[model samples]
Target: MYGPVCFLAPAGVDDPQRPSGGNRYDLELMRELGELGYPVKLTPVTGAWPRPSGADGRELSRLLEALPEGSTALWDGLIACGVPDIVQAASRRLRQVVIVHLPLADETGLDPQVARELDQAERHALHAANATVATSRWTAAQLTEHHGLPGVRVHVAPPGVCLAPSAPGTPSGGRHLLSVASLTPRKGHATLFAALGALPRELPWQLKIAGAQPDAAYAAHLHSLIAEAGLTDRVSILGPLAGAELDAAYAWADLLVHSPEKEPWGMVVQEALACGLPVYASDVGGVPEALGHAYFPGETAFERPGRLLPAGDSAAWAEALNEWMCELRLRDRLRTLAEQRQRTLPTWRSTALEVAMALGGFPSTPWHTELEAAPLATS
Candidate 1:
C-alpha cells in the first residue's frame, strides 16, 4: 500500500506464464490486490536449484540486487523454503512480508535436513519482515509448532473462492468421480488409487485424476498401484488439463475427492465446491479447516457430504466411498452442502480487500492480547 508491491516466486516451468501451486496462489493474490487499487507487480524469478533456468541463479541474484531502496515486497513462493541464504542478503531494509501458503517442515516429512534449513530460513524471513500472513489457521499452527514464530507476528488470511458455478451435480448412480492434485506424496494419490482398487468391481464408476505428474518416481508409484488395483480402464490419469479441458472435466464429475495428507489450503477443494460438486476428502490438513464438516463429515455420513474418512486408511476410504456411491438421497443432499459452502467463502475481489486491510491495518486490539486471547482457526 506504500511503495510498489513486488511478487517474487520460483519459475519452475520454462513458460514464464505457467505457475504451479504456490506460484499460482501468488498470481491470484497479485490480480486481487491490483483490483483493490494497490500497486502490485509480479516477477517470476529463477531461484537456484530445483527450478530449471537458462540464466540460472544469476537472473534472480541480479533482480534481488537491483531492488530499489525503501521499496516494499510481498515475497511469495518458497524463497525462504528453497533458498534460505537469499532472505538475509537480499531483503534488507525492504518492507518484506512473509506469506506462508504451507509450512516448509511438513513438506519434507522424511528429509530432515531440507526441512530444518527451510524451517530456519522461513523463521529468519519471518523475523526480518514487518509482518506475516498464514493462508489458513492450520498453517499458522504448523508454523508455531515447528518454527518459533512469535504469536504477535503471524495472522490468518485465507484466499477467496469466487461463486462461479452456483450449484454442482452430485455423484449419482451414473455420475463420475474426479480428483485434482499434482502428482506428489502429500497429495495422497496412492490412497485414492488404493481405495478405488478396494471398491467392488461392478460399482459402475470411472475415476479421472487431473493435473500434471512432473515427479517421475511418484508417477511410477501411482501407475504401479493402479495396475495392481486393476484400474487400468476405469481410471484415467490425464496430466494438467486446463481451459476447455478442465471445464469439461468439472462438468462431467458428479463428486470430487481430494485425498491430500496435508494441505495448507486446497485450491482444488474450493474449485470443486464452486462447480457445485459434492466432495469427499481426508481429514488431515487445512482443507477441512477451510471447508468445515458441516459439508464434510467425519467417521460417518454427512448430510451434505457422503462421508469423510481418516487419512492413510485405504479400506476405510473405500468403505465410505462405496456407501456414498449407493445412496442417491445422500448425493443430492451433499450437492446442496457443497453449493452452500461455496457461497460462504469470499470471492477474489473481497480477498484483495482483506489483504489490503492487512497491509496498512492498525491494531484495534493489543497484538498480544488479541492473539493470546484466542488461538486462530480461520481459513
Candidate 2:
C-alpha cells in the first residue's frame, strides 16, 4: 500500500470545455487511485506551462515549499519538466515522480533554440525525480536516448480504452471520417486538410473534426483552407465532444483518420478500435504499438488492421484514403481486424493499478516484475 500521494498537473485538466487525452488520463487516474483507497490530493498549477512566466514560477515555488517533506508528488511532466529549477528544488524535499505524456522538446513547431532549452530543462528535472512514468514505451526510450536520462527508473503505463459497442458505420450512400484530436500544430490538421484536398472532389464522404480550438489562429487558418479547397460543404468542425456526444460521434463514423506529426500514444486510436472503427493514422511514435502492429511500411506480409502511412506524407495519405474508399473488400477486412483487436485492450483499472504499484516501487507485485523484465519497444 502507498502513502498519501499528491497529483500535480496543469490547471485546465478538469475543464470539460477543453478536453484532451492527457487531461482525461490525469483525471481518470486520480479518480481511480482514490477509488482504490489511495489518499490522492490533486494540486493543479495554473499558468502558461512549458513556458511559465515569473509569477507562475513564484506560485509553484510557494506550493512546493508548503508540501510535506516526505510527501510523494506525482508531477505531470508538462509543468515539471520545463521548470527545472523548481522541480530540482522540490525533488530535494518531496519524493518526485514525473508522469510524462510526451517530452516537451518533441512538441511540433518549436524554435530550435527553444526546443534545445526545453530538452535541457526536462533532462535536468527528470534526472532529479525518484522515478519517471511514461505513457508509452516509445516515450520511455526517448527519455533515455534523447534526454540523457538513462539512470532514471522509468515505468511504462499506457492509456487504457473504455469498452464500447461497435459503431454502426456509415449511413447509406454516405461515408463519414472522424479525426479526434486538439486543433494544434502537433496534430497536423493542415497536413490532413492537404491530404483530403487531394482526394477526388466527387467522393461521397464527409469529414468531421472533433477537437477544441486551443489555437484560435490555427483554427481560423484551417477554416480558410477548407473554403479555399472547396471543402467547406464536405467538412464540419465539431468542437470538443465528451460522454454521450463523443460516443455517438464514434458510433456514426465509418473511419478514423488521424494525421498527427507525432504522438506519445494516440489514445483516440484505441478508442476508435474499441468502437470497431478502422484507423488510418500517421505512422509516428507509439501509434504502431497502439494499432497492435509493427511499423513495416511496404511489407505486404504484415496484415495491419489499418493503414499506417509515413507522417506528413500527404500524397500517401490521399492514396490510402482513395484505396480504402473505392475498395469495399479492403474496408470490410480492416473493420473486421479492428473488431478483433478491441477485445485485447487493457482496462482503465489495470492502468491505475500499474501506476499505484509503480508509486510504491512495485512492492509485492509479480505482474510489475514481469512488466519490468519484458523487452521495451524500440523506435
Top-TM-score candidate index: 2
| Global lDDT scores for all candidate models | 0.68, 0.83
TM-score of each: 0.86, 0.91
The candidate maximizing lDDT is: 2
lDDT of 1 by residue, 19-67 (tens): 2456556777788888767789777665463333446556666776777
Candidate 2 lDDT over residue span 186-248, tens digit each? 898787888889998788889999999988999999999898888998899999999999999
Off by over 4 Å in 2: 171-174, 293-302, 363-379
- For candidate 1, the clash count comes to 3
Q: Clashing residue pairs in candidate 1, if any?
A: 168-276, 211-240, 304-334
Instruction: Give me the runs in candidate 1 sitting further than 4 Å from their true place.
Output: 12-19, 48-61, 108-110, 166-174, 293-306, 361-379
